[model samples]
Target chain A: MDTNQPRWQRRKDARPAEIIEAALTLFVDKGFAATRLDDVATQAGVTKGTVYLYFANKEELFKAVVRETILPNIESGEHLLADHQGTWAELLWILLERWADRMEYSASTGISKLMIAEASNFPDLARFYVEEVVMRSRKLFATVIQRGIDAGEFRPVDPVMATRAVISPLMLIKVWKQSFSLCDTEPVDLKAFARFHYELMMQGLASR
Target chain B: MDTNQPRWQRRKDARPAEIIEAALTLFVDKGFAATRLDDVATQAGVTKGTVYLYFANKEELFKAVVRETILPNIESGEHLLADHQGTWAELLWILLERWADRMEYSASTGISKLMIAEASNFPDLARFYVEEVVMRSRKLFATVIQRGIDAGEFRPVDPVMATRAVISPLMLIKVWKQSFSLCDTEPVDLKAFARFHYELMMQGLASR
Candidate 1:
């Protein structure tokens, strides 16, 4: 798009994103404890000192990975909720469809599995993830569910608990793809799985 | 109860179970790739030779750990399905209640988290778990769901996918307890979580 720009300038501008992309790949493949910053530098085709220029440390690099890759999805979902003009059920369906689409196709889906696997070993990172990503995403869902309850479109369930219930199946599928799908003979159809899970949640949350 | 039995004979009889318990603990705390049989032997208070006497290798030890700790829960769940005498909703409630009780209080609950974390590294073992534990458990839930549909007690949905929907939350909770619970400021109450999940599922699956 910017072919007129100098190649050196373009490379300089792209370096941080390229490093973050490399870091996400490595973090997802290897647990946080086993991944090294120098390896990330090698994968990104940058020097380790260059990596330190963009990121203060491995944890910061990881935080950047989360911020760059996942936070956008959360932001988009939040925007969807804020701008939605339809039945709460329709809004929920759209939000989940976007989510399932990302989880099915995006490399960032593996970050959740990585977090689950390595959370105990890195308590600070885990807490950061919980506060930054987990709670934020859950808040988005909770807001939608609470609005549904207020509008008498959903059953009067606690928004916090309802958010957990709605999210758990999606979380399970993400973890499954990263781990068990390696040996799973009959892998789930991601679309069917998502459709059925959303249907179940819709039915469960509907006002009677 | 067996106070009259000789100490050596009793210890000999208990060796396999002791080793299995130790293996489960180590395998859960440290993943399969990181856990060494010698460490398990040490934890079990047995010699390396003693461990080998019972288990052919680490894989065998892991398998035995599953069979000892997890299979029993599955077996008992099967028995509950076979012996149930109630409405399908009530039966499902009881089944989920029992499962939640075990997950909250049992050592075996950690095995689910362990398998999720290490399944990719150990594909053969993952396949083993899928066949022995996952499929068997799903079959139990599918049978109940199928019966409910046939008897006009629940909505018609794919029993296989429905079984997945039902189990996913429980899986998430198990993983959370082992990993994110370390840093989660507002950890969920296990009973309330189980109850709400069960309620949500029951509503989702109802014939209404």
Candidate 2:
């Protein structure tokens, strides 16, 4: 590994990435307000000056972490729509299950909780999350619903409304997990819940 | 006002309530950690020692506010369920609309945001909210669903699952109000959304 690296190559981009990774962990653990730049430097095993060289302030560093780490996961979720060739209900289920899987990780939960706590004070961060992450994801789901309505695979539902119905249940799982702190020890059985929710959403209260 | 006051009427309970009311206003404006007891005293037109005479610390004062102001709202909500006799859908709509109204209030938003920021460190507060507030509400809603199922008004859906379905869409409103700071200027058109949501929840994606 040493033989492959030139002295110039070693100093290029690795330090910034390392600093961000360390800062993310600290921010999640102690929260953004509580965690300081010196703490990030200590966690990253770098000098305060070196950390400052990469990022100007704690807010800037935190934003970079959000952009770098969180945004990529959302970007990758776009791929779920590409292979969606099944019935709208089938596609909705698959997408919801995929979303639940993504949400199951600790890093995602930590970031989400941190965002909820801080988003009020920092409107720009909240806007970035809504526009970049939430609206985009909802748009993808809405497109599938629109296709379903056009094809007569499902009822003549408002695609936007239907999209919210399909998405909201999965979204509430995060609220449920955090609010009640249920399923802390065990996994939430999200697949079972997803299937049940999908069935309830598809069929009306009136018996066929 | 002073001339009308009896010696027994002007008591400790009166002063404590006045202090709590002032503290709630300050805490809502400046946040829990940011608002000092001195500010509360000034707002109440009392000395700081007088404020301390009623409550031991900031946490106790906040708990008192939650117990007095917020918890009563939940109790009145329960009474709403008891007072009204309607179809499950109608009852559910009423309950959700009331919740949306509360979320739209600025003071409620401030207190809830403060709670989210502090809940990680103050797990007892979180647990109290879940057990006292959320679980009771869920159970009440679930009972309404069960009654609907028994009356053959709804299809044979699992009442617990149906309750989750009914509540899930409203979560979007709460998240939008709190996390994104939307729906603050005016009343959210919850009835329209509720109608749209409940229709899809009952009948599903199939076009009639």
Best by the lDDT measure: 1
RMSD in Å for all candidates: 1.4, 4.2
lDDT by residue for model 1 over A1-208, one digit each (tens)?
Answer: 5999999989989999999999999998887888999999999999999999999999999999999999998999888888899998888888888888888779999998889888888899999999999989999999999999999999899898888888888888899899888767668887788889888888888898
Give the clashing residue pairs of candidate 2, or none.
A155-B205, A155-B206, A155-B207, A202-B204, A204-B202, A204-B203, A205-B202
Off by over 4 Å in 1: B1-4
User: Model 2 Cα displacement at A94 (Å)?
Assistant: 1.8
In terms of TM-score, how similar is model 2 to the real structure?
A: 0.82
The positional error of residue B187 in candidate 1, measured at the CA in angstroms, is 1.5
> By summed lDDT, which 10 consecutive residues of candidate 2 chain B come out lowest?
B181-190
DockQ of each: 0.76, 0.42
RMSD of 2: 4.2
lDDT of 1 by residue, B16-123 (tens): 989998888888888888999889989999999999998899999999999988898889888888898898778777878888888878888888778888888888
